[model samples]
Target chain A: MEQSKKLSAGILRNDRLMADGRTIRYYDTSGQNRSAKDARPVEKQPAIGELRLDPLVNEWIAMASHRQGRIFLPPKELCPLCPTTGELLTEIPESDFEVVVFDNRSPSLRPPTGDWALPDQVGPDTDLGSAAGKCEVICFTAEHGNAFKDLTPARVRVLLEAWIDRTAELSQESFIEHIAPFENRGEEIGVTLTHPHGQIYAYSYIPPRVEKMLAAANKYKTSTGKVLFDEVVAREIRDEERIIARNDRWIAFVPYAARYPFEIHVAPLNPVADLTGLTDQDRDAFAPIALEVMKRLDGVFGIDMAYIAAWHQAPVRVGRDVLRLHWQITSVRRAPGKLKYLAGSESAMGAFIMDMRPEQSAAQLREVVL
Target chain B: MEQSKKLSAGILRNDRLMADGRTIRYYDTSGQNRSAKDARPVEKQPAIGELRLDPLVNEWIAMASHRQGRIFLPPKELCPLCPTTGELLTEIPESDFEVVVFDNRSPSLRPPTGDWALPDQVGPDTDLGSAAGKCEVICFTAEHGNAFKDLTPARVRVLLEAWIDRTAELSQESFIEHIAPFENRGEEIGVTLTHPHGQIYAYSYIPPRVEKMLAAANKYKTSTGKVLFDEVVAREIRDEERIIARNDRWIAFVPYAARYPFEIHVAPLNPVADLTGLTDQDRDAFAPIALEVMKRLDGVFGIDMAYIAAWHQAPVRVGRDVLRLHWQITSVRRAPGKLKYLAGSESAMGAFIMDMRPEQSAAQLREVVL
Candidate 1:
């Protein structure tokens, strides 16, 4: 194991190797040493997933057949994400920790083994490429039943710090092109674990959505000599119809062309290519609104809404100037006991049909007394 | 009301007007009159849905706030798609019918009122355009509990005839650039009605997935001087591993890079641009294989698997030579009671992570006794 290093925002980083040859990193604010030994039995490493290029849509599909046997909605007593106790050993070796991140045991992407060059054109019989990237699991807290909404602002800031540190560290890999840090909350969205946690997926190729945004930003820049992200925030502020929450450094608003019923975007007032570029003050301002927006979402329907909170960042080596960082939170819950399923049109045709207008959703969000 | 016209395959087409001034077309194999009046209360016409271009992805989002109140999971006694009885006035105004097509009461797209032109570039504050096209509901059978798998091959042929006639007719509308015929089955995928029915959407612009397929096909055609769809079917034939069901004119195979746990694509053996281009013999051979594939899917788990059956055809005006007709059926059911949800990686990043390999799923499908 390497020596513990000090990261920005007074975060102490300790990196350790698990028994099965996987890396685990602990980010603590108190700067405690995390050298506890993993007491579980070592097993053979699973084979890496394969990435096949879909010729019909020109996108990559990751086949992780080994993941079919991963842990599912386990009981609270058997939760693997909780800190290790005297009676039971879990994924984490330490008795307690502020924040922790480790390699996924059955990852959709694995660390690259060799050169990761892909063919220019793919056919039906083309050889599949290795999913030569990384997938990491980030535990927000050690508490089993707590949610992200129950975290304090200071703890939220610590989570943000961990995200920044991991994003910067993952970018050093030669095969990585994009990094996505996201949280899938609520069992309605197929969250296998009851504990509050997030995941970071490092991709060898830029994802399709990010690629589309990059292309759109570049086209807008060439045509108008203006950044499209800036224009979007400015327009949201001027319109004021979809703005739900705002602070000095950040704004959270429902986009005019939202595809989901309850969709919100938290963007910095100034241009920031990625989370690593956020200043200390900017990070401090983001924590409060982030919690407020989440509370408002739960308040609207008075239930735990199923949502996917995704961070859209620029590519590691390209599109830094045009693609800006934004946190997009979208919920599948349209009404009480009803979910918005991606059926034939949305799933197969890539056409979105919203059940309500964005302004109505924004008004409902704003009316919530959080 | 227009006179009952004789269509291909000895089918009679009857066009009628409902109380709300909507058009309803009934396709019958028995050549019976369908002039029964819609006895429901006439209300003011709802405002058409608006199309907002998402600048981030450059795709149109249909905002149909009126659809929120559409009928959902009605009891068997009150199914809207069933033939009207003495006490119940349903959408279908007849006592019995072979197959029927009618305008959706709460449509996402309406008939173009005037000239429909979209701006070349959309900004945040761009005025939204009307959803200028058509949305129609197709009732496969008048029997309330009979599913598509239970239908006779002759009845399935009649349904295919309706699809072909509708596709050819919708192409005449100047505003329509693409036509999609799809079925969303089971409550898991948000099928509001319990009857065995489908929908046809006449799009004013090419959808995102179709657009991507078109670009890929065009590129492949230019480089290889061959059609991409033909190459895909031919490759599936040569491999023979993923081929689940086949006939003289059609083949149903799991693609090499399937996005869903159970995905099957049924394509014609010859070059057929759209459903209208299919010969009578081709249509006859397709009905049996389609039923076989659906039955095998249900037989895999001894349950009615929830699925989306989407028909991908050539665009109304463009990509006719490169894009061929096919049916893509994908299920979210991973196991008996488990579903594969579109969470972070899929819903947000447009990345798909399959739980199992295509060959494994194909073998399972092939082993099922239908």
Candidate 2:
């Protein structure tokens, strides 16, 4: 096996050299790496807002219109991601549609190509990936809106199957290392494209964080001579301070040092890499826990709670199979919106100074029968 | 000087030890140092989050309310941090208030009586260091509403003066290492008791991060044989990609791996232990740049953006100040709230993946003539 030399170049050796053959390219402290990038100063829509990155934490923040604020404050009566191109209405039908993957036609930007295909490289200026891989929408209903919280377990299982199907199909591209499918919901969380949908990004590289985790898991395996997550999941099951809800096959717990309040992680009883390993029963087992967690968030907060549902699977590359696949759900109510601060410690210093204890949170979460 | 005996305890020394007797402590496999000791909850506010230790990367995460949502959206008129105590109508005041430091009327959680106050050999939980320390409010204003962004330069100068007074007075504690003064604005960024006031936390030990930075700085200094900050700050100035604003004495820039959107770091030309070294002339020069950045953020988002204004000063106890005292202003606007997701990269994995480039952001910020 060729050792990957990513962080720097040159140093490559034998079996012991993991990420060694590929140079670990150190980004020059200078601004050169960012030089080639180009951004379109698109006309800002009063309906939508401008987005920028918070330089400290490196997260993208959107500044939407006051109208958008009104939409967020009030519940969603509209589903924007609906409007299909070519005689398509902005309003989606109230009934179901066939599982279709098409280019987002009603758009200022979509990879302009003759054929319905993904770009080889995908970005702002260059159509790399250069295809859109598979751009599509999974409308559980054509009507206004609802989160996975409103979906029946059977419906959710269908959604999971859709996800599994998409992942498998997208993975055929040797260029794609990881495929991410995520969903955003409610006005509070800011869902402009409200047609209750999730997206799949067939990434070119194993994102930096996943890359690091692969290294850590490998290290853990080498040292303990066993799986690291196995130890963690067992230890968590034993302690139970952070565990919110768990069934026979799946467990959801608040991670230690959770950056956001009400951050939940749902994992399998064992590690899984590819969706090919998932049985028809796996979807049936996992969908309920996710829904329960969502219900608990809404029940506890009183109003619609904003959350990001992320499915972190192993990269399609060589070693992701041994890694664990899980979903980390985060809601931002850090004390009624006035005090969920990512301050100097967490932002610049990387220290998470949290005011709440996991046990107390779990007690409250577990108490909620929803 | 007595070494921090954390290594000898149940905690394993993470990373190799330094000959100076300094070693990074891993609480557990996750860089968390948990044992029978820390396992006993501190009987504090119902733990909303857990701090996970990452031994490999040597970082801590707060995982309490990991699933709660909508952190920064504030009440329309009712500011919750409004005073319930006395004549203070506005929790976040508009006018200036004199610097007042006194013993908190609230009962101490640690309960100090006699010998507890008199420091000596004591158990970890019984240690009086945690008790004697005081927390105060620097009422930035006397009137009810407004934030650090709203302050005039002269008013900001006044607040800066208060910071100097507190830092000098508190460093004499013999136990106090760092004096952390931070302000949280907008409901979403976690401003509990929304007063236009900043908090002062004088810690007994330098929280793990300050300690880590000192080592990184020391190592950077050793490798290059130059002041790491001086070299880095100069490079940032030259690159100008991340530079937010420049003043005569200080230069403000968004950090490369910024943990938040529109995060600004203000670094000084001259490095010092505390703010006393800063002459009024210099602070006056820097205030507008600070104000300018805040104004630009509001302009960029076109709403009152939520942010954390935190100061990272040298630990008061350990006299060796690591000349990296700066303010990190972070707002959570990762793509207009619609796509403000802290995905696996930033959350589970420590790596930061920013969608927006800093140079483009700097260009946008520079265009804002605040």
Candidate 3:
């Protein structure tokens, strides 16, 4: 293997291929050997999921039936995210690693096969397409018991670098439209794995949410000659009440129109279209703020908040300049034991009825000191 | 008080004003005495929620902060939907009633209280408007420990008549745009009260999902000179593989692109724009099919399947002819204990990655001999 590149913040990156033709990568604080051979036999990759255009919404819905048998809250001893040690072989062949990312065994999307299906056969006004792209799981640590907030600053910096490198590499794929790096933390959010990990989904098409944001951004630009996300950041900064933490490069604040009970947005002070555009300084500055926001979230209700921390980045093939990168952390936990579920109105109608006001939630979050 | 009106299918309807000036209606299989005074003291009405335009999606999000402390899984004794006795008082004042519909105490939307806020002051590109409409709860049965599937055919017909009556009555209000009568069943779907109840939300603006459907329907009409929903039902009938049940008046089938693990769509064979448009014969025919579908859903896992049964009806004033009324029942339960949670892809990006195929789910439902 070629010499490992010492990336920003003393992080070393080494890439490898798995037995099933999936890519795996390791990021280490210390430049160490991560090259390990897969002991398990090569297995046939499952068929790529089928994407059908929903006639009602004119949107694509992925049908990943193979994922039905995927792991669900597996015992810690059989956790696939845990590093392999002795007889306990896992997804990672490495005995130990600071950070590791591997292709998901049962992915919603995967590398396309040669075969393709026609649209007419799927259904009326429905077009069949391959769920082409990548879905990777990033394990923060092999220890598996700690939360992302407990990670050291150096570790978080390494994770951020890993995210940037992956985004840059994944954007090269001609068909990939958006790369989403998100973490579904806590069982309340349906997180099956207790390990402190996240997922990266490289979608073949611009997702619905991102598409809507792009349209809004373009509209805002046409109307006001200013970026929509930039205005949002400026407004939050001016308000100051919702601001959780801020530095020269990054600022974290609860959005004015939060859909969730506990929702916060962390964005760079300067506009960055995607993670690939983040400078070393930007990455360094974001780690502490992100960590602090997560800590504050946990402090609220004195428990680990079940949240979906999603990185909203500009689509790779379009809307790069107008759309700005931001991390949205939305928790459904309304109170100590209550969860705000997306029921009839929210689930079926896509009209969110927020239980708490954003200003009140921000005040509560601000009161929780790290 | 006015004499009870004998509605279609021998259902009796009696309307009265609550202590707080909210409307309450009772539906009975027989024209019985439904007059019972609310024993509780008059309570102050909650302030109307604010409607904020979510710039990203161009959608209105209802900020109903007053709903934070709403009843959540109340005990059987404190069940608000239960019939009030001499010692117990509930939302339904009548000591004995077949089925009742009353205004929600903690509503997402309500009649405007005349104190309206300005738009520009809320936020950039955000509009502030009163959540001016109605939110009502419909008790399916007087019993607190039974599912909708367990309701008798007579009771189901009465419920259908109530839905039809409410749709017609609520549509007369100038501010009501769409009336959504849906049931969030089981604790899994966040049904706060276990009193076998459903809810009707009369929204001032068209919901996001309904708007998309309307746009698609209009586009389809312009392109093919055909209504989109009618074509969907026709296509499903022709395919036959996804059909779960069919009768002369109504047919239930799984959609081509179902976003949930167990999703079934029930549509009238003859086009009906909304519940108000349903004839007496249509209502009678629909009750049995709807009940059977629910029974099969429960039998799929031999347990009460938590599902969201939403009525997708035409808007009050627009697209009444082109848009068809349909019932969409979506269950998150993937297996006996597993649920398909909206995690990273779904919750964050509005991209659904379903674990089950429509055909397979339909076949399973069809196999259940109910």
The residue-level lDDT of candidate 3 at B39 comes to 70
lDDT of 1 by residue, A1-370 (tens): 6458888778888998888878889988887889898889998888788998788878899999999888899998899999999987888999998889999999999887767766766765577988878999999999998988888898898899989988998999998989999999998889999899999999888998888888889988898888888888898899999999999999999999999999999999987999999998998888899999999999998988889999999999999998999999999889998888889889889999999899999999999998
Give Cα-based local distance difference scores for all models: 0.90, 0.51, 0.85
Cα lDDT tens digits for candidate 2, B1-370: 2122221112222222222222212111123322211111222332122334432232444333333432233553454233223343332221222322222222111122333333332111121122334445556654456766887776666567667666776777654556777776755544544557666666544555566556556665555565555555666776667787777878888764454556677877776656666765666677777788888878775777777778877666553544466776776764455433454334443334344445555666677766
Q: Kindly report which residue stretches of model 1 are placed more than 4 angstroms away from their true locations once superposed.
A: none
Window of ten residues with lowest summed lDDT in model 1 chain A? A117-126
Q: After superposition, how far is residue A362 of candidate 2 from its true place, in Å?
A: 2.9
Q: Where is the poorest 10-residue window by lDDT in model 3 chain B?
A: B116-125
Residue lDDT tens for model 3, B1-370: 4346778767778887777777788887767776787778998877678887766567788899988877778889888788888768888888778878888889999866564333432225465777777899999988889989998988888888888898998998877889999999888878888889899999988888888788878888887888888888877888889999988899999999999999999998889899888876788898789989999999988888999999999999898878999999999999998898999999899888998999999999998987
What docking tier does model 3 reach? medium
Residue B332 in model 1: lDDT: 93
lDDT of 3 by residue, A1-370 (tens): 3236667777888887777777788999877887787788887777778888888777888889988887788988898888888878789989888988888988998866664333433226565777887899999888878899999988888888888888988998776789999999988778888999999999988888888888878888887888888888877787788888888899998877789999999998878999988887898888789889999999989998999999999999889879999999999998998999999999988788998888899889889967
In candidate 1 chain B, what residue range of length 10 has the lowest lDDT sum?
B117-126
TM-scores for all predictions? 0.99, 0.63, 0.96
Q: Is candidate 2 or 3 superior in DockQ?
A: 3
